[model samples]
Target chain A: MRTAIIGAGQAGRRTAELLRGLDAEREILLLGEETEPPYDRPPLSKEVLLGEERPRGLMQRAAEVYEAQRIALRLGEKVTRIDLGAARLETAAGECIAYDSLVIATGARARGLRIPGADDPRVLTLRSIADARALRARLRTGLRLVVAGAGLIGLEVAAAAIQLGCAVTVLEMGERAMARCVPEAVSARIEAWHRAAGVVLEFGCPLTAIRPQPDAIHLVTGKGEVSADLLLVAVGAIPNMELALDAGIAVDDGILTDADGRTSHPHVFAAGEVARIWQRGAGRHVRFETWQVAQHQPVAVANALCGEQKPYAELPWHWTDQYGRNVQILGTHSAALEWLEREDGGRLIYFGVDPEERVHSAVLIDNGREATPLRRIIAAEKPIQRNRLLDPSVALRQLC
Target chain B: MAWHDVAPEGEFEMDVPKVVQVGEDRVAVFRLADGFYAISDVCTHEYALLSDGFCEEGKIECPLHQACFDIRSGKALDEPAEVDLAIYPTRIDGGVVQFQL
Candidate 1:
């Protein structure tokens, strides 16, 4: 049987790994748009942006591992078309490949600033390794950086830039940082962390235009004009679902998939940021562009492809590092969440509860040890006992 | 390698990892439901005191990046950290916790 995975990101790499494990002799082809092999994206802002490390360490495995496993990695090959009926894919290189099972893991693409001069060469986004390589070259001590958003990527890049001795300023359209992802309370706290570290955050402001100059880049904002040596548009990311949509596969916010990652077309599946798996807790299909979900969803997809069925119901979680504190979000992060903050000695844990106290999520900052058990509670959606969850004397594992 | 006594058994709390200086190395000694195991006190992802990190279910999540490490085996459990921690041979002698450096 031949299984073809399109994308070559974490999801594609994971699907290839699982397929090899399930059947040693199955033919597998992994296609990626970028020339580079599958590498981790989380460190692009942290390690590679800071010029502290190259992306080599973030690779799924050494290049030789692919040959050893008999997995063909067709790098720099973008799958331009997918014919679900024929179970075939056409690449940019004008090569057509047929497969018994196909996975659309095309991941996400960075959202661009559609304002005037937005296409200027000085303006960049932090999505691909190429972007990171160029950004790293231009970033130096005394370089002024104006980030367009205070979301995860923007704030992370701001922190990394500050560490590299660059003058950093972050602009956000929302009233607080990560407003869509975390509760207001969490946003305000993290905002303080950013400001305290000498990073300037201008909230309620959005970039209107970017004008390139010989010496500096001029950015027009709601407040006034600002000139900086570098500009990064980190508004957010949109799922790359065009290939699936063009091929007549279902798509909502992302490519629609059943619990087992089976798309609308039989013999075709989806995973990672590109797949909107059915979420039981939310009672709707939702897509999460998180590192944790991208690393895990392939297991269920591979199981179903191999005739071993298992629903994809893993509780979503992802962690981010900023300045010196490590913040972990378990289950979900939503604006509608009501959090109950607990202080155990010096550690802080926020439990996201609904009106009836049904636990929905939890954010643990500088206390990731609480994550493992907290994940179990969030996955079960158990009723919250405020006192028990608040008491650090009581281990979170025992509470569940 | 030589074993050096760091702390008494009573000094450690159940499931709470403590960082103890053993000559030139800082080690995090964990007291689990079973016994004790030791790993490097430094997080491989970044420079952070692993003593201040969270420990549960025989794993320590780095306070800076949340990179988890299995205390028993010292294997890195997730992203942002791919390097396995250096786990030292540990044993308790006469109510004292000791680790081989």
Candidate 2:
């Protein structure tokens, strides 16, 4: 049997490796829109943008490893359409690939900035390796970098640019940074860190339009006008669900998939950043563009494809590195949950609890050490005694 | 270098990792359930101190990016870190923990 996997990012490459390991005889075709080998995505905004590291050996496997694994990797090819009934995928080059089982790991694309100067040459988005290389060359000591969003990617870029001696300003529509992902306290601390680093952070100001000139790009916002040598639109990402939608697969923001990675179609499956998976206990759809999910989700998807049915029940956990500080978050928080915070060794740790005082999420700032055990605690949804969680003497292993 | 005294026994608690200077080398001395084990304090991933991190199940997680290193083996068991840490032999001399500098 042959397996065709679409979009060769972290999820695509990982799933290919898993499928190859599971069954050697199965034909595995890994397709990617970009020709570059799969490099770690998180580092693009951190080390790579700062020019501290080169883009070498960033792949899941070396060339030799790919050759040894005998997996067919097709790069720089876009899937134009997916015919679910025929089980055929049409590529941009007019090649119709037939697969017995298909996995749509198309992942998400960067949400674009829609304004007059949004499509200007000076404007860039750091979604690919090319983008990183381009932005790295443009970043100089005196350059003014105006980041459009205050999310992880945007903030990370700001930090990298500041390190390069560039004047960085971040404009966010929301009142706080990382509004969708992290807790308010965490956001406040990060904002403070950015501000203290000489980064001009303007919250509650949304960009109205951009006007690119020969020297600098002019930005008009809710507050006032600002100019930039180059602009980065790191607002957010929207899932690449059009291909799935064309195939009549149910897509709501992302490719909707069950716990076992099976989509609406029988022989078709979805995984990675693209899959808005129905989380079992959470009773909600979750689409996480995390290293953990991309690296681990394939095991369950591959298992189910091979007739071993095991659902993906891993708790959502993510981490970010900024300003030489590490932040780790397990699960997520909404307004419904109660929050309790503790300060350990000058580090702030916040725990999100349900109405019954059951721990639902944990945010550890500059303290990623507890993330491993804390992930289990969140997954278990165990009723956390407030005093025990706050006590430093109490070992996390014992409490969980 | 021979065994150099670093800290008093009472200051080092079980499963509590601390950083101390053994001559020139910065060492992370962990008092496990059994005895004391000393490894390099600086995380192999980032420059964060392992002493400032978390410890459990014979593993010391680097506070920087959660990269876990086995206390006894000094091997990095997780991602963002692939290098192993240097381990120094230690012994309790009198009431002080002396690590080989």
Candidate 3:
């Protein structure tokens, strides 16, 4: 079989490796748009921003690994279009590659700012190794950094800049930081930590425009106008679904796929940030943008190729390390539910319940100790008493 | 055979692990439904103390990175942990817990 995998990120690399391992006789081609090899994206806002590690350190596999696996890696090549009827992919370099099976892992790109001076040289977005390198080169002490959006990436960049003695300010239009992933209490804790680390937070504020100045950029916001040496826009990301949409495949927020990573079209599959998978537990189609999901979904896709249909239904878990603190979040938290906090204040486990107070999901903060046990409890659907659940004297194991 | 008493069994009702000094090594004693088991307190993966972790069934979960280990066999359960812990014989006579190292 001739297989062509697009994107060359974690999901693309995993699919290529699995295809090579499953069928040695098959010809595999891994195409990446970036000039460099596959590198970890999570570190772009952390280690790369802090200047603690280089972009080369984040490569998933060395060059020799691809050579030894006999996988043809085509770098700096962009796929212009997918010829679905002919079963071929046309590249920008005017090369057409025939493939029996194709994996679409085009991933996502940062949402660009659309203000007046959006294209100014001082405005930046962190998505690839090149973006990180460019941002790092411009970072200097006493430089003012205005970070739009207080999401994970924005907060991380703010923290790193503050640590490097830069005057950093974060602007979030939302009521609280990390509003999508964490509870308000957890957000409050993180906000406090960031304040202690010298990051100025501008919540409930929106950026109206950016005007380039002689030495700095002027940010026009609802609160006030601010000047900064660099402007970082980390609002969110948009999935790269143009190719998939053009190919007439289903796309809602992302490319819609079954649990086995199979798209609507036979012989075409999707994974990574670009794939919107049917989440059985959540009973909805959800898209995940985490390294764990990218690493895990390829196995299911490979199994599906072998005639075994297995759905990917693992609990969504992710961790972020910022300002010397390890923050981990598991499951999902709803604001309507009651909060049960541990006595030590080090752990906060939010319980999601229905009208009858039946536990549906749990969101734990900084308490990896209870993660495995909580997973089992969530699976068992055991009824837990409200008072007993909040008792710090009682071990979490006893609740099980 | 010298059996030094470490902690009372009731102390483990709230949490399984109770750190105790046995000879020169610091050991963590866990109380499960079956019985009490003791192992080295320090995590083989990092400098985290095993006694501060969450215990469920027969496994001790690392508080730092969530690496789980079987309390009896001292074998690591998953990734991020490549080394196994050293297990020591533990027993409970009456209400007192003792370790045989």
Scored by lDDT, the top model is 1
Scored against the true structure, residue A360 in model 3 reaches a CA lDDT of 57
Worst 10-residue lDDT window, candidate 1 chain A = A52-61
lDDT of 1: 0.84
Best by TM-score: 1
Error of 1 at A203 (Å): 1.5
| Predicted candidate 3 versus true structure: per-residue lDDT over A1-400, tens digit per residue | 7888889988888888877778788788899999887776877887787785553325456767898999898899999999899999999999999999888999999998788999999999989888988898888899999999998889989888898889999999888988888777778988998999988999999999998989888999989999999999999999999999999999999999999999999899997889999988788888988776777788777767656776788777776667766666666656766655564476667666555555656666656677676676666677788777777777666666
RMSD of each: 2.4, 3.0, 4.9
Task: Classify candidate 2 by CAPRI docking class.
Answer: acceptable
Compared with the true structure, model 2 gives a TM-score of 0.89
lDDT of candidates 1 onward, in order:
0.84, 0.84, 0.81
Candidate 2 residues A296-400, lDDT tens each?
787778888898877888877787888988888788767577778878777767888887778888888876767767877876777878898888777577767
User: Which CAPRI category fits model 3?
Assistant: acceptable
Q: In candidate 2 chain A, what residue range of length 10 has the lowest lDDT sum?
A: A54-63
TM-score to true structure, per model? 0.93, 0.89, 0.83
With candidate 1 superimposed using the best TM-score fit, by how many Å does residue A347's alpha carbon deviate from the native? 2.0
- With candidate 2 superimposed using the best TM-score fit, by how many Å does residue A227's alpha carbon deviate from the native? 1.6
* Candidate 3 clash pair list: none
Model 2 segments beyond 4 Å from truth?
A55-60, A385-388, A391-395, B1-13, B18-49, B74-76, B80-101
Q: Specify the poorest-scoring 10-residue window by lDDT in model 2 chain B.
A: B16-25
